[model samples]
Target: MAKIVLITGGSSGIGKAIGEYLQTRGYKVYGTSRNPKNYKSSFALLPLDVTSSESIQNCVTQLLDIEKTIDVLINNAGVGITGPIEETPISEIKNAFSTNLYGPIEMTNAVLPAMRKQGYGHIINVTSIAGYMGLPYRGVYSATKAALEITTEAYRMELKQFNVKMTNVAPGDFATNIAAGRYHAPIAQDSPYKEAYGNTLKTMDAHVDAGKDPTKMAEVIFKILQNPNPKVRYKVGAFIQKFSIVLKAILPSKMYEAMLMKHYEL
Candidate 1:
């Protein structure tokens, strides 16, 4: 029997790539989407709304009823939010955290009982490179992913004895449709951050436009699944993006801030 893998947000982007690749590699892959009927996928695409606890329970129950057990859970469903901190709506910030942080947490909780009963499981939280730092105009997005990353660190220890493993895979910009769904606070003419925020948004989009192929992320996931003892965190992206995390560890605070300011031309 092949491993049963459940991936959230698998209808497209990194999640889609991982699901398709894993299926080709002989795993039983199931991806989730809010509107499963709207997207065509090679593997099973089930209906899921990560924000709702009821939706999460239904999706997991539906999958478990068929598969008997879930061998892997990929928390990849996330939304993007970008804007100056002050201008970004509080409601939107909460929504981002709800989707990116609370949703993943709830999903993990939903599967833990089955996983513990089976005595084996792997949970991979798809975070972001942006989570490693507080980027201008993307602070909310950063915070949500960062919280997930830290949460996984704690989960790993608690799940160790149960044979349930959890890790965070933080990817940098990748060519995907994420930009289309991201919330952007309008650039008001009189706002203090309009000019800088507008320029930063363009830069962010251009980076995504020129980002590496999503297949790269898929390959990384495949390698991770093969590992009997995976690391706590893995990062996939350009050298600079990965290195940014390293630099933050070694570089002086002001110096690193200067580098980011220069890169964003803010």
Candidate 2:
């Protein structure tokens, strides 16, 4: 029997790319989108809204009815929000956290039972290097991912005895539709920081527009899936982007802040 893999937000971008890649490798891939009716993919399409408990449960239950067991899960559905820290509304930040952090946590809870019963499984949380530092206007997005990263650590420890594995893949900037809904700059029109925010976003968009191919991330994920013992985290992207994680850890706090401000032209 082919192994079954379920991915959230698999209708487009990295999630879609990874689903296609795994399908070609002989895994039975099931991908979820908010509206699966319109999604066209080589893998099976299912409906899911990760922020809702009932939706996550239904998606997993429906998949299990046909597949019997789920061998792998990729929590790839996420949203990014960008805006000046002070002006960004609490409601907006909460929404970002809902999809990026809470949704994954809920999805994991839904699938762990099946993975545990099967005696072996793997979970990959699609994360970002934004979690590593407080980026110019993506503070909320970064915090949500950071929270997921810390949770991944705790889950890894707790699941070790159950033959379940979890790891985070923190890609730098990948070209995707994530940019469209992410720019939360309502106050950019009138705030004193308007010019700075505009400049910072332009710089951020340039990197995103020139991001590495999504296939690169898919390739790395495929390798991780095939491994018997994957590591705690995987970073994928340009040399400097990946290296920044190390630099942040070694550099002093003030120095790191200065470096970030300089890069984003703050």
Candidate 3:
């Protein structure tokens, strides 16, 4: 029997790419959207809003009732937020955490029981390269992804004995509609950060515009599924983006900060 795979935020972007690729490879793929009816996908799209616990549980239950076993779950649903941390609204920051961090955590919780019962399962949290380091004007988004990445590390050890696998795949920017949905704290004319924040925001958008294809991320996920003992984390993106993580590790804290500041022209 084919493996049953569920991806949150499967309506579009990286999630959609993964679902399409896995379906071609013979896995049973079902993706979730806030409004499943709004998007048309080759595989199934169920209604899900990761921020809502009720919606998350209902989506999992519905899938379990039909599939009986969920072999893999890709927590690919997330929102992007960019602005100077000091100026970003508290409500927006909370919303970002709710979707990017808590949502995946809750989704994992909802699926674990069935996975434990079956003695098998893999949960892949879709984090970001930004999570590995704080970027100018994207601090909130980075923090949310960073939180998820750390949470996955803890989950891995806890799920080990249960025969459940948990890992994070952090991607650099990919060409997607994420920018369209992302929340931007308007640049205030009188704000001290107006000039620097405006420039950084434009740079960030340009990077996404020039980002690699989403299919690359799908390929990485497919490769991860094939591994019997997958690593705790996987990164997918351009060479420079992936290398940034290494640079951050080897460079002195101050030196790295300088490099980032220079890169962002801040």
Candidate 4:
């Protein structure tokens, strides 16, 4: 029987690339997306809104009815909100946590029983390098991913005895619609740091425009899935991410902060 994998946020970016690549590798891929109209993947597309419990439950139920078992679950749906923590509204912060953190938690809970019964399953959460190193103007996004990293570690330990593996993939600067969505945050009219915030947004856009291809990250994920014992965390992207990790290890906290400020022109 072909292995079954379900990927959330599968309509575009890294998620879509992973779905397509896995399909070619002889896995039966089922992808979830809010809008399924223009998706051209060979695998199935299930309607899913990660923020909606009803939608997630329905999507999972539909898949269970068809496939009976899911070999892997990829939690890849997430959004980005950019602005200083003070400038970011409470509503935006709530929405960020809802989609980025709660969505994955809810989806994981829904899939656990079935996975546990099977005695074999893999759960891959696509986090970001931001989870490890905080960046300016991305407080909420970073917090959500950081929460995910911790949750992934906890799950790795708890689920291992049950024959379920949990892995977190942290990719740096991937080419995706995440950058476009960053500009959609409502600007705070009373924000004292308006000019700085605008500059930060501009810098982010430029970096994303020159980021690595999503397909490269997808390839790393594919290899991880093939391995019987995947690492607890995999960092995917350019050498800069490794360098950043090393810098964080060697540099003092204040010096590291100063270096980031200088590099980002903050």
RMSD of every candidate to native, in Å, equals 0.6, 1.0, 0.7, 1.4
For residue 3, model 4's alpha carbon misses the true position, in angstroms, by: 0.6
Best of the two (2, 3) by lDDT:
3
Q: Which lDDT values do the candidates have, in the order given?
A: 0.96, 0.91, 0.95, 0.87
Q: Write the per-residue lDDT of candidate 4 for residues 14-122, one digit (tens) a residue.
A: 8988998888888899998898876776778899999999999999899999999988999999998888787677998998899988999999988998999989899
lDDT of 3 by residue, 75-183 (tens): 9999999888998999999999999999999999999999999999999999999999988889999999999999999999999999999889999989999999999
lDDT of 1 by residue, 1-266 (tens): 89999999999999999999999999999999999999999999989999999999999999999989999999999999999999999999999999999999999999999999999999999999999999999999999999999999999999999999998999999999999999999899999998999999999999999999999999998999999999999999999999999999999999999999999998
lDDT of 1 at 251: 100
| Candidate 2, superposed: residue stretches over 4 Å from native | none
lDDT-better candidate, 1 vs 2: 1
CA lDDT, candidate 4, residue 209: 82
Best by lDDT: 1
Worst 10 residues of 1 by lDDT: 217-226
Better of 1 and 3 by lDDT: 1
Worst 10 residues of 2 by lDDT: 181-190
Model 1 gets an lDDT of 0.96
- TM-score ranking from best candidate downward: 1, 3, 2, 4
As a TM-score, model 3 comes out at 0.99
* Clash pairs for candidate 4: none
Model 1 lDDT, residue 123, Cα: 97
| Model 3 lDDT at residue 262 | 93
TM-score of each: 0.99, 0.97, 0.99, 0.96
Question: Which residue runs does candidate 3 get wrong by more than 4 Å?
Answer: none
